[model samples]
Target: MASHLDLEEQEQLEQVKAFWKQWGNLITWLITAVLLAYAGWQGWNYYQRQEAAKAAAMYDALDQAVQAADADKAASVFNDLRERYAGTVYAAQGALQAAKVQQDKGQADKAMASLTWAADNASDDSYRDIARLRLAGLQIDAKQYDAAAKSLDAIKSADFAALASDRRGDLLLLQNKPAEARAEFQKALAAMDKTLDYRRLIEAKLATLGVAVPADDAASGAAK
Candidate 1:
């Protein structure tokens, strides 16, 4: 019985060896590939963290330059951040800050350039929307009413709809198109939150056009 058990164990060991001989190399290569992939992923995460930290530091410096009212320094830092880290949110924010500084310094052309860059390249849609809104306002100030209207028309956010409509009304009013202005004012009134004083202001505009907004209906619509 001892000899029979020994023979059985030997046969089992031989079978296991045959299986390993057939598949061992393939199994080893698969495990190596998986480990390499995991290592690469971890390395990439570390690289991204480092890059973001550097971009954030540069953005802070740009903000400080803007706070000091150093338009030239702010512009230089902002350009560097935008060129090097355009993929980062901080870069877009830095551009907006630089644009505001340029505007305050009476450099309308430079301000528009920064705003246009932010509008075109911001990684965040919300940031791009804000840039476009600000650019439109500047265009309006420059009396480029048609271009401002076109910019406002391109904005698609429901949250910005009221403000965009109000801006459109302003542009139309500036152009002496009272009927078109009234239409935009009505749309603004419809989009605005009932509790907001701005909604009342829009309502007043509509009233001037002999278009009465029903208070109860507006309140009920807002409640919904």
Candidate 2:
């Protein structure tokens, strides 16, 4: 009976070895793959953090240049930032800041170029919309009426609809299309948030056009 038990144990050991032989290589390879993937993920996250840190430092330099009101320096730093860190939010913000400095320095062409870059390359939708809005205003100031209209038309976000309408009103008024301007202002007033101080400005615009908000509509808007 002892010899029989020894034989049974030997048979069980052999079955275990056979199972390992069939599956051991596959299990080892799967574990290696998982480890490699985890290491790659960690490396990617580290790279992103390093990139953001570098971008933040460059953005700080751009900010200092802006504070000094050195338009040329700001533009130079902004160009560097855009070239190296265009994928970062800092680059988009730098474009906006540089554009403002350029505009204040009477560099209309440079300002427009910066704004156009932000509008075309910003990762965030709101930033793009803001760039387009400011660019439209600058185009208007330049008396590039057609270009201003094109910029306004490119604004796609509903959040900016009222502002875009207001700008369109300005454009139409400049073109001596008062009737069209009034319609656009009315659209702006209708879309604008009633609680905003800017809404009152739109109302004043309508007033200048010899149009008044109907009493009932005014009351309804106030109630809202």
Whole-model Cα lDDT per candidate?
A: 0.89, 0.93
Per-model C-alpha RMSD:
3.1, 2.6
Candidate 2 ranges beyond 4 A from true positions: 1-13, 215-224
**What does candidate 2 score on TM?**
0.88
Q: Give lDDT tens digits, candidate 2, residues 106-135.
A: 999999999999999998888899999999
For model 2, how many clashes? 0
Q: lDDT for model 2, please.
A: 0.93
lDDT of candidate 1 over 2-118, digit per residue (tens): 999999999999998998899989999999999999999999999999999999999999999998999999999999999899999998899899999999999988998999899
State the weakest 10-residue window (summed lDDT) of model 1.
215-224
Per-candidate TM vs. native?
0.85, 0.88
Identify the leading candidate in terms of lDDT: 2
Best by TM-score: 2
